[model samples]
Target: MKLFLTCPKGLELLLEEELHQLGVEDTKQTVAGVQCHGDLEDAYRICLWSRLANRVLMPVYQGDAETTEDLYDAVQQVSWLDHIRSEGTLLIDFTGQTRAINNTHFGALKVKDAIVDQIRDLTGARPSVDKVAPDLRINVRMHRGKVTVAIDLSGDSLHRRAYRLQAGQAPMKENLAAAVLLRSGWPARIADFDLLLDPMCGSGTLLIEAAMMAADIAPGLQRKRYGFSRWTGHQKGIWDELVAEANGRKAKGLSQLEISLVGRDEDKSVLRSARQNAERAGVAEFIDFAACRVEDLEREQLPEGVGLLVTNPPYGERLGETQQLMFLYRHLGDKLKEQFAGWTAAIFTSNPDLCKVMGMRADKQYKLFNGALESRLFVYPISERRPEQTVREEEDVVPLSDGAQMFANRLLKNRKQLAKWVKNEQIECYRLYDADMPEYSVAIDMYGDEVHVQEYAAPKKIDPVKTFSRLQEIMTAIPVALEIPANKVILKQRKKQQGSNQYEKQSETHRFKEVNEYGCRLLVNLHDYLDTGLFLDHRPIRYRIQQEAAGKDVLNLFSYTGTASVHAAKGGAKSTTSIDMSATYLNWAKRNLDLNGFSQGAHQQIQEDCLKWLRMQRTPAFDLIFMDPPTFSNSKRMEGVLDVQRDHVDMVDAAMRLLRKEGVLYFSNNYRRFKIDHDALSDYVVEDITFSTLDPDFKRNNRIHSCFKITHKA
Candidate 1:
């Protein structure tokens, strides 16, 4: 028998390969579908076991239909009584093309009328139309005046898989989720890791799927029906035998398998749904489900082996603001750093900004599509080491002084001509002042492209409006001077304090603002000297974080306006906690939280030093946590320079104290050459989370931030 399998766009190859692997012969791939020749049993097996196919269609015939009469005649020519009995119910589905019969319903009606009329004329009885529960389901596809008719072999969408009796918010389709896992190289015979984890487990699709694969269980075993069973050619005895054989092949002693599989979510309802789904899939015994916040996942002992952690986190488009997502990614990085050492991690996400917040380098990545959204999967290999081993030290890779030198050299080459032109053209905001002194020559301002100026003078006095006006004027003329198109130019002015007391004016500088871009409203903010406006270097990290957050709770510490929180929430974190010290930043975090629709009780905002908060908290807390602190800071409210390197032990200990028994913490610091004091916390386990943090944009700087995961000793 010849059969055609349908799937979403770009997945035809995957399904075709799957069909071949399932023993179907002569498989061919096509746009939006795949074709293969097989026996009725093969069709049944494919319908049951193929993971990537959406629907199986048995093509009955194909012909050209330039008019409605042609379509009706073609439909009547088929032996309708062969597939549909006069007493049975029938339903017709039509997809139109460039034919004269353009209306889908009208075309379907014509086909239905022809079939019924043929049946009545031949047998003196007519089948009833049952749209909801039709005994015979026929599909008609018309494209470019060519019509192909087929019978639907699978009744419902293959994604149902009959495994999920419940679902989490923004749950992923089973087929897509399985495809991601398979693409990630899962189900190794000798698994490198003794565990699989989905921190944002949602309704536990990823976790349940992982567990089933680990146990070598077929996903279709739970499904009770297929469209083929209703076909005239269906052999009950062959299907029964196939089922028996599949049952005989059922994995024995899965309960005895040493691997640990777990999922965590903040929403109890979601967790409940996940539990139900797992039960229906018959893999309930193999998974551990928890209703917990992302900040509370702690590391549990495994059977003396490494494990793999995979997740599909929320993206800002579905869940939260960009800053909030960034905050979630940051905390996810922190949690991975704090826990799950000697583990491999893979995350699938669509948001670039959220990937930046993870603060880890991904060893591997793949461009993929999560439905309509283009996404990426980032793979991070966790290492057993001191947390500092994971930190990316800017000084070691490229010293700040060297960076300053490079900046100066570039400006010097362009400054003379620029300054001369600025003076000649009477360009305002020219290099009236320049930090040319070696100790202070760090700032450069340009008016027009011709005004290649450098400042050598210190800040004795300055004009704000006058400087801005000059810069704006230069911005307007630079494109013209450079012969660049107006649309190609981006002009922005640097904001500064207006008065001495302005520094004392505490306002929420990191509050979320909705900006229209790419046909959607995106939340962004500008505050802090650390480029709160954007962390262009962390784009990869945000993408990775979203991939991992599908059904997990996320914790973002040192959340810094909660950009990571936003990413995690968007990536589908059940809950998130964002912690920082500044009230202004906390308010900013709130704004980000609100913008992402995650400002509900599930997510939390705290204004406190993350270390202190960790110390005051209980253990077995977070599944994923992100901690990225300033390299140096001296606030009157706190102590001296807040060095991440010098204070990593206390910080790790505090975070671990709040981690769940099997959770992860991504501890990171921007301090260049920052080293971990391992001996100070010899009782804990640490793993490097640095290799996955590298971003292509940060090519000049290797160590964007050093990060590590620490967990309790197994």
Candidate 2:
């Protein structure tokens, strides 16, 4: 049978590769989804082992559809009685394009009507529609006037997996959380590492997923029911055989495994939930759950080798307070710096500002989406700083601008060959665009006929002669690799004024331009922000959006220069809206959209706070919404700081208000300490969409961003 595997936007390739390694045949990519041919046993095996797929679907039939009658006729022609009995309960899910069948519920109603009509004609009775606990679930997808119907082989989303017996405030889905651990290189055979720890282990999802992986336990083993079980074609013997094989493969020598796994949370209820989840996954014996604040966590007493610590902390979005969380993160960083010597630590958070409080530099970083929150996973390899390192006061460094023009002239002359090379080779994008101090140290972008550049001034510690020489060497080497002549490169130094305040000088000196690359136009300006023009970490997520975006309306909230929007529009979003408070960013977004030929009436650029705009919008506005808010932002225009950990409930509520009933909202944030206010959001159905967004490039950093897909409860 042919099967479809659905995952979050970025992980299709990963899922495809996993399927191939498992020996599943005919694996291929389809938009944001994947397709493979497998028997009932293969389907079950995928459910148990696939770390990337969200659910497994078995296609039953496909036919043409031009109207509601055509849809009903096509659905009715399927042998419904063969798959679903009259005594069972049924549910229908609809997706994709259909003119008369646009609304999911209306489409579901038509399918249900057809199924009942067909069943009644044959059996004299029909199954009832049960949205929850349906014995058999059918999915109908229409693409370009063609309809394909499938049976949802997995009952609940495969992410449920039955391992989680209890949940904390904002628990991650088992599959997604597991994918993070796998992507981060956790649970591997590493030597000389202390242990794997989640400092803010709400519900222990991360810890449980880690423990399961460490034990080689199939995630789906705990699930008791599947949609296929209710279908007539399900082979009990095959399923039993698969389960036995899975059990036989389960790790028996866990004690022989080198690493220990630990999770700590401040909430007592959350600790209880974590323990309960661990027990459900049958790994309670292997995982240690403790109730403690991040500040109180100490390095375990182990042998000489250092351990690895990875954590997802609060983003202060939903909790209504950020100052305390910021302070906690700062203290957490201080503790790591002072205590966890020789240990490698990865911090997952959507909040860059909070990350700065740690006052430590990460050795590696990756972009990930936690739910719909855009976040970063910063890996700080902690060990003793080189003893030769010494603190120097700002007063110690010589000023390069004290003698400016002579230095600038010399730098320009040295880079003359490099500039010509840049133009000759058409080096579209390169770092260190300019290094004219007294003026700026800028990065240059060569986009065919356009030259986009960002300017930066020299750092206080660097000497003019040394800085210019370094810039010349870098510029020369980069263009040569691109086969460009040095005369084509344009080098410019940023100007600095005497007695200017540090903040003013830094803010004024930096500038950047947008460029188009790989079918998407991006605004790649690294000078003004810590991140340059592109986020290589979210490379997968953008790929997913582009792949799945054809003919869909995309809503991008907190759309920083609309990178995702650019990808989505280029991927074929019928319309796109980029919302943010900064006009500067909106203008940049417009430039990117224009570069992609999507900056016209079909795309809307809104310069407003997303929260405010969401509150003002009505329902059924967009098909897909991508929201990645800052961990903490206190704009002068807003009444308070926008905190993801604290404001998530409200943010979700607002975003959902604009979503079409069947539409999905991809909400993400970088707040490592973020906890979902599940109680506050009991009405909407939420799934942790993080795992499907994990890209291989982000293996070093876990919890890049916590993402969730939410829709109104059916």
Candidate 3:
């Protein structure tokens, strides 16, 4: 008999191979499934042993199904009396529709009518529809002009191993977990290795599947029911023999099981769920569960033997939150090297970009899907020791061309010019160069010991090769001129940003440097984002806040990392409120506040759109408010697009409504063409403090930003 076995889309080939292992040859692979030739015994074995298939179907009839009547006639040719009794319950699963059969519900109803009529006419008894658990579940398919009706032998999807009654936030299906283990070569490597581990194992899906595979236990052993249990052609004698053989093998396999299995997770609640799932799977005695974080995992925690370490870590659904998980991935990578030596590891994640900073090179990768989300399983062979850095100082030092030397000379001149001011003011971060040479169009900034380079996008008229050559020259000149290690130099592109593009991340390296400004310690990520957390050009504005914010209620709008709020808190402000739409940045702001020993109720960090939050306020509570909105924002999270030039008057008016009678409002933006509507706001006083806010480094480019102070006439 011909059989159709269904599985996930990417597992068709694996399912075919699994069928071959069960002594069923002449198999053909199709999209998301396979077709094979097998007898009743072979089909029963597949239902019991095949871990990748979702359903095992036995085709009973084939005919044309151009219309609903055609479908009804096609289903009637299946010999309903030989499959189900006249008084039994039945279900019809219809898939794919032809031109005449446009609706699946109508098609299923016609098929049901045919089966009920045939049974009643032949045996004077009618069958009833049962969706919950049918005695015979018939599957109908309608192609271009043909149909193939089959009986579903597996009552439920094979992925439903009945082991996971509870799961973590996101759980991997049982069949997918089995596929991951197979692709990771667990069966082939089990003899050489003596252990298996999953550091971030949630609900123990992967662990239980591995145990079943190693012990030769049938995945459907714990299932209480099957589609063939009540069918007339079940062949009770054959099924009973297969069950006895399977039980004997299972008893032998479990007695000889020698490998140690361990599962760990940081969340204690999820660990409890995992233990319960393992117990339900009947493999609890073979596995060990613990509540431990990946960061604290040590070499002593494992047994003396080396084995395979597999885990499924949390992959963020939101792109912005992915940047926040960089450190977590890095920590997992660090522990892989520090704890497990000479062991193989398989790490699965939906976001491969976050794996770039894991510090381990993947030896092999397989594309898999966790439900609708596409993911990858990266396999690495852990070495005896962590790999050494390939970069060396001698290799980076090279001769600079004349053009490169000219750019280097200008950099030295700027550093000499600002050295005295930097020393006297105790500055830790400042701009070193800003498009000083037209040929080398890049801005270089110094953040303590590291350097950040932002190359201006070249015009379309320039040659592509020439543009790349100039960038290479700049990279070589910076380290030599500044006497810094080549690895400390991070480069990024600078272009005109729209909407929230300026706030998006550029890389996966969560390298943050701490800098001091006005006696306030702030954290700045120089590599991950387009803009560092602290704006160096706004040095004077932050210093002014520190001087006059004593005993004042402060509010910081469009607070990217809350650097200004930290300044206010350091100056003894009564309370400070920081608002921003990006939760990624708001969390960064909270960490900055905590680093400065200001983690108290006086400092409140809010995640919301600045404009919407301001309009919702009815009380005049703040004494000082800083409003620095984007030049033009069309972020989907906001109600509407924001044009700083067109909406400044209304934004200021909203802020003024929230301000006390004698309070002040400061507005700023980077739109060079921005013009304040002085006439629209005749009721208040607006002072253009653009020049006073520019520090010495940004003096060359006076139009970098615009600042103004607005207050009520007093």
Best by lDDT: 3
Global lDDT scores for all candidate models: 0.67, 0.71, 0.87
lDDT of 1: 0.67
Instruction: Give the candidate number with the greatest TM-score.
Output: 3
Query: How would you encode candidate 2's per-residue C-alpha lDDT over 1-714 as one tens digit per residue?
Result: 899998765456667877997789698898657999987778888977876778788887888896899999999778887887887889998887566767877888888999998888888987898887887889898889899999898878878878777786556666556556655667653555557778899888887777777767777888888878777777888888888877876656354555678788888877887788788778888777878877577765423456777777877673212433555677788788777777888787777667876779988776656667767778887877554432322246423332343443444554464566445634444332334343434555444433333335456586633554444444444344334654444443333322111112122334555554556657665334334546444555676778878888999998877888988888889999999887867887888888777757999899887788888888677888888887777677665677678788888888888888778788777666677777898899888867777543233244657777788888
Q: Point out the higher-scoring one by lDDT: 1 or 3.
A: 3
Q: Each candidate's TM vs. the true structure?
A: 0.55, 0.53, 0.69
Q: Of the pair 1 and 2, which is ahead by TM-score?
A: 1
Identify the runs in model 3 with alpha carbons over 4 angstroms from their true place: 79-92, 102-136, 167-171, 197-203, 229-241, 262-273, 288-301, 305-539, 546-624, 630-646, 656-663, 670-687, 694-705, 711-714
**RMSD (Å) of each candidate, 1 decimal:** 23.8, 24.0, 7.4
Q: Model 1 over residues 118-236: C-alpha lDDT tens digits?
A: 98998899998887767878999888878888888887778778878767667888887877787666875335666787888898888877777776666687887777667665678
Candidate 1 segments exceeding 4 Å error = 251-257, 300-304, 318-320, 383-714
